[model samples]
Target: KIKRMKNLPMAALDSETVTVVKRKVKTKKKKVKTERKKRKSKENTSLKGKSEPKDKKIQVLQKNENNSENVESMKIGNGHDIEEKVNEGKRSKEFESGHDFEVELPNKKQKSSFRKGNDVEKSGEVSTGTVLKKKKKKKNKNAEQNSELENIAQKKIVGIKDKMNAKIIQATLNTKYKEEKLKTALKKSWSSNGYPLKIDTCDEDSGIKLMKRLPPLYYAPIFFNFYNLIDSPSKRISMFYFIYLFQFKQTTDLKNASTPSLSALRNFLYGPFRKYLMNITGIELDNTVDMGSSLYEQTDVLLCHDDELEGRRIAYILYLVPPWDEKDGGTLDVFHTDKNGQPADIAKSFFPVWNSFAFFEVSPVSFHQVSEVLAKKKRLSINGWYHGSPVNRPPKFVELPRPVKSPCHIEQEDLYSWINHVYLDPWTQKEIKTKFQKDSQIELEQFLAEDKYEALLEAIKLKDLKWHYEGPANKRHYEVTKANKAGELVRECLKFLRSEAVFLIFSQLTGLRLHKLAPPDSEDEEEKSSEKEPSPCVSQEIRRVSHGSYTLVHDDDPVGSQYALDAMLFLGVSEKWTQALGGFTSYIARDEDEELLTVLPRSNSLSMVYRDKETLKFTKHVNTSVKDLLEEEQQFYEVNCTYYE
Candidate 1:
């Protein structure tokens, strides 16, 4: 019964539990048998294809072995270990294909692979994350640098564009001014033909008859009295002169006519006469508003000098109307030589106050334009030039006698200086008159004996001369006649002689009207040369005569010696001439082991001599090498020789 109970215990086990155990036992037995069968099959297969399978297995094993070896041997680095492993894999592949590969991997790939290891965590190698971070940082730095460079390039481009725009604006302004000037000039030319006057009166006899019929003057001399009435201290008479003349009952009335009040004349002149003249002249006179000083009210008048004149004298009258505002448009523009020897802008303005007259030599070179009026006041002045009379009459007055003790003497001096410096020096005036005369040639002897000429030659030899004439070839040879007058002849002459050593030497040596060469101070502040301003360690007046033509007027104050040297350098004048002038010789050493002798010509009476350095003997002539002279005058050579040669 006990045996039966044990068997029952075994039989009474749960069905689920009994089935699980049986299945496990069967699965284990089957697995064991399958493994045995597989091993047996594998052995048989290997036996059938032993050589091929063995080789493949050996290759695979070798590749795995090599990969493992590379991984182990690789140093922990960023991408370096990975690169080694990848290269090992490639080599294994080439080996399996039975092909020799000499492939070159790119530098970046090599570096990346060399940084990463197989077991990135265990090797403590650089992970892809860390490598990406480094790359990103480098990229960010490069981008910043590129951005900065781009900004700089953009700024430079913008600055250039701005400059271009400014130049365009200036050009536009200049063009506008030119157009206005041309229109006014044409109108004046037409009006001067007496287009509005009766045709019969155009004849000289008729004009003279009309003038003779006018009333006789009593307050002053017949001729000078008329001027007094017009020039009355009263602004009313000055302003209403035309109206009074028209309203006068008889010729004798002018003699007893009392001058009008100044205020009344000023008002009339400002309101009606100014407008009338402007309308007739077609010159939109305006005052300069930005003038820094109150000494003068600026007025502008524009004119054009065309080639159509053909050397004939043309007469026209100008009426000045002052501005209401003292600072308004009042500049008088004059044509002068530019840096390139072309006509340049030289303008001046007169005060809008009473009794101001500006008269200048009339020619093609005499370009005058009025400034804009700022004060809205009327300027009153009569404008006329003396026209030569027919042969039967007395000599015609070319210029009005200058008023003495004039209130505007300062202005006059400035204007005179400018005129003398730029255009009509005594020499220039003589030159012009002689040249305009028939068959007139410059006589060198005419000026040689003058004390001024002698002094000038002495100054030039000492490098102290500030001004000299620059004239064209054949200027001295040609007899210029009024019949063959040309406007630009003088200017052309100056341009030709700018770099002529022979001309400069002759002028200095002969002492002929050399004072005419001085560069004039600009009457108009705005027309002042750029080189006239003070600069550090350099105080000199640099007047550009024409383009590429310049003159340095050094202040003969403290550094006269230095300025003399500088003048020699600038004019490229010969030291031989200096040596020929006796007793006032000074030695100047140059860098090229050369010496120059500075001489003053007028030391001895009327003879060329040289003072010897070693022996104090005055020789008849000195040997000053031309080369040394040229070197000493390097600036002049550069400016004149380089351009002309």
Candidate 2:
């Protein structure tokens, strides 16, 4: 029934469809009008004259659309362009909705119904907010970094400044203490009356003071025995006797006397209190040249020619007082030029403490004497001279009608050659025998073999080897070591030996012409040598038979003396032998005795010899044990040689 009805109502259905179509059309028209009105309202509200010109606003809108399209194109999401369009439409709707009423323009010549002030203020407020936010962020970041750095710097600065302040305080305190101590010491030294001479009494008469007199120059003369001066116990006597005569000239008329009894003067001069004189006075007066027929008597004084004047022209005296004994009275007396250039006296006293020095000038009138020794113990001191310059005149030899034959030259050349040849060819039996032979042929052969053959021959003719030592122990081992290692380690082990050897050689060579080299007194002899042992002087005399005196002979050529020639040859041979022998080795035994361990060439075997400490005698090893020697002595030679090389 429904199907038949549907077919029959075609006309009616057509009429209804038409009516519906008309209504739809009308609604669509209404919607379009509404949309247009909304768009217009939005445009009127948003496009105010203050925002921008109409054309510029349109351009900006178009630019915004293009930028949105570009942003959508860059997006990866599906339907991104559709979503962006929807968002833009929504934004446009929202903008339109926000405009409650449509803005009106008064006329073409009047401005649009929009205020520039509110729009500009709103934009400016937004920009200013953004700028302030950025500035705040940057300032926070900079402030944080700066605060951190400042904290670290402050921590370091505190420690550094504290340390600097502490150091400054310590330095100030130390300086203050040092200055105070120095001032105190200076004050004490200045106030002490330890010096021997009193400045106030310098002008007193020289005769009134026993210390000023040359005969009894020492104070408390009664305490000293006068008999010991004439009898000297030492082997070497100094040439200070001449100075003594001059010093005593004011007290006695010995120079004018027909025959000066120097022996009597010597006897008178001896006294135990002389040490006190040395302490208070600088004078070291002694009758050294008064020996009968002594060479010094014949030799003319070179520096001072005047007979009347005596005493050291310039001298230094060292007074050493022991710290434990203040009453020992060690003082130094000095002669100096006064303000008017006349001789003036000055004195300084020293306590035997370490690092004490007393210095004063020396002159002719600076005569001074030491006080008598009150203590039983001896006082130690050193005295010497300083000349204006080197003496211009040559040393004057003893005057004689003809030059006396020096007994030393002949013995020196023979002994030197023999020792040199033995040392050079220690293993050569033939050479040794030839050198030792008594015949002139053997002696001539040895002389010819020497480096200074002419000199050796002349030395043999003159006999100038009085002071030579022949024993093997007398050889200087240290000297040999030094010469061996002279290249790189110049100041090594060899240096010590060289220094000691020089000192010993000088002691032996510088004849007893100086006060320091004076002959020993009886007390000194007793102190130095044992009662059982023979005197060193007697032994020296016996040795003189083999090695004669070193006096110059008339037969010797003036060009170069035979003695000098022999010395040169001996020195050369010694040096050569030392090098060839690989230096010398010395050992100190367990018994406090010294020994020599000679190394054999090519064989590498050590030959041992025992040396007597007192006499320095060498003997073939017998009961001596090598194990007993000090380790240093045993190894020093080998180690020193290797290190030096």
Candidate 3:
């Protein structure tokens, strides 16, 4: 989920909305004069004073156009002026239309089926519509039942009033009142057919198995949050919030976990709620609910991960929010499935509603993320995992495609062509190697051939071409062109990177014995089925790093990982790109707080570096200060390849 405006529309995070970490009440859009119809929800889970909050409008000012050369050149506008303007728009919209925000759900067919406690076995793949009809019973809303339920609740409350602890929470959950109320909410949730479970599979073409998916998620409702008997502290519960507020300035930071305070919320989740989950889903959850609640605010985001932790079976989130506009950010954006049946770009975004309870089975294709919150509001939720069940059929592991062997030596003809495209001469190459030997990193500007670079720049502007929104927003936010669909220039770039000339050049420049270069594509079935031969290198696709595009820090390289030489060739960049506006890479020594090197993604610059055991690197997120004069202005078109020595 997005911490603030950073996650919503990365392109929109200029100088407009302000983000403050706190709890959110729902957004009220309309009021009616119709006679009050008594509500049934109160009878079961009565919080008489805890009624749903109407919309509380916080006026946000749209950022003024400031493509001024410097990142700090943005001029701040008056808050009062912006607030008044927002009010004017709101009033007029209310007069003209019944709604304040536009509600747009994507048009997609949903197939979901779940039966009640009795019909579990037959319900696995049945139609939800047919089963829900049988589940909902017409119970009259009368004072007699309400009073009886309230009386039972008072007795249970008085009986367990002593020693406000975890046992009490577990006992209360077993009580008929809590069980009945939660059961009703769960049944309604399954019956409502609110979540979409489509056959979103992976694209078999790519080796990054993560991009493929087969997901059918459950978006649990609001009442799910209060299922626990413990009274969660008013101060909340989001550790994701403080990370951005405190550590936004640091470039190497990754995710922030929960701070221990809200024992009530944690106990409720791990205790009785766990039992209720078993009753509904028919899966035995693990003993402990790893109580790590995530809070994503402005720029805070959880990138793409499969959540394949040991002992974890299902991943769950209970949002502590009132309803609000979907555009407010804090959405659970499920990735679209690639040809591999793995998760790909973001296909759908589920915004945080105060009472939302959403969960999904942790599997290979279960790659999901939080989009940037474009608005100034807080997206708060409690997240945990239920472990100890048989891993929902793990997808077959797919290794990155085998290396495409190129010649070990560079021919003179290839050298000349490379020289024409890139401005590196023998002397400059010598200088680069010398600097690399000392620092294990070097940046060479004008690295791409002039004509080739110019042609590719034009090719990227083609509107007919489809660019995948590379996601799991916590890890990265950008787009990538499918090289197969893209025409000549993209093809040529791929070839050039994999060419014997460039490989030998890089090998010599870095003093590494690299032989083969790997492309980011899957191997043939024969190759996949056969015994794997030892390879000399590993690499990935040519990526288009655009606005809000980022790579967070993590201990990614395995002990025996084949990544010896890493290269990032920057292209398609505008002159307006500045350090203050991000789009830079940060290299840090794992043992210290110091950032070892900062590499800017300047146009036509290639930064090739050696990875030491104690070092890690990441591309800083691109900010919204750039003019975006052209569509490509937001992009860092580059070939990130690797070599095994």
Give one digit per residue, the lDDT tens place, for model 1 in 1-645: 000000011121112121101111123678757755764566324222111222111111112322333211111111111112223222111011101112223333322121111111212345532111123323242344334443443454345434433333210111221245533632344332222212112223111111100010001011110111233322223211111001111121122222222223333333453453345343343321110001212121222231112222222222334334435545443344333323343323333333332333233334344443334344444333222221132222132221211011123332332112323245665554344232211222222223433343333334322333331110100111121132242223223223233223323333322122323333463244333532111111211121112111111212322211122112223344343221122333321212243333222122222112221211111112212344443212111111100
TM-score of 3: 0.53
Ranking by lDDT: 3, 1, 2
> Candidate 1: lDDT of 310?
24
Q: Each model's TM-score, in the order given?
A: 0.18, 0.17, 0.53
lDDT of 1 at 499: 25
lDDT of 2 by residue, 513-569 (tens): 112233333575546533333211100011111101011112211312211111111
**Global lDDT scores for all candidate models:** 0.26, 0.24, 0.51
RMSD of each: 35.4, 40.3, 25.0
Per TM-score, the best of the predicted structures is 3
Better of 1 and 3 by lDDT: 3
Q: Looking at candidate 3, what is the lDDT of residue 294? A: 48
In model 3, which regions exceed 4 Å deviation? 1-217, 224-261, 285-287, 335-341, 344-348, 360-365, 387-396, 402-405, 408-414, 417-427, 448-456, 459-504, 514-541, 547-560, 578-598, 612-632
What does candidate 3's lDDT look like per residue over 454-565, in tens digits?
7777786677878776643434456777778988767766666766666656755665555333221235633643454334544546677765677655443342133456
* lDDT score, candidate 1, position 170: 19
Worst 10 residues of 3 by lDDT: 91-100
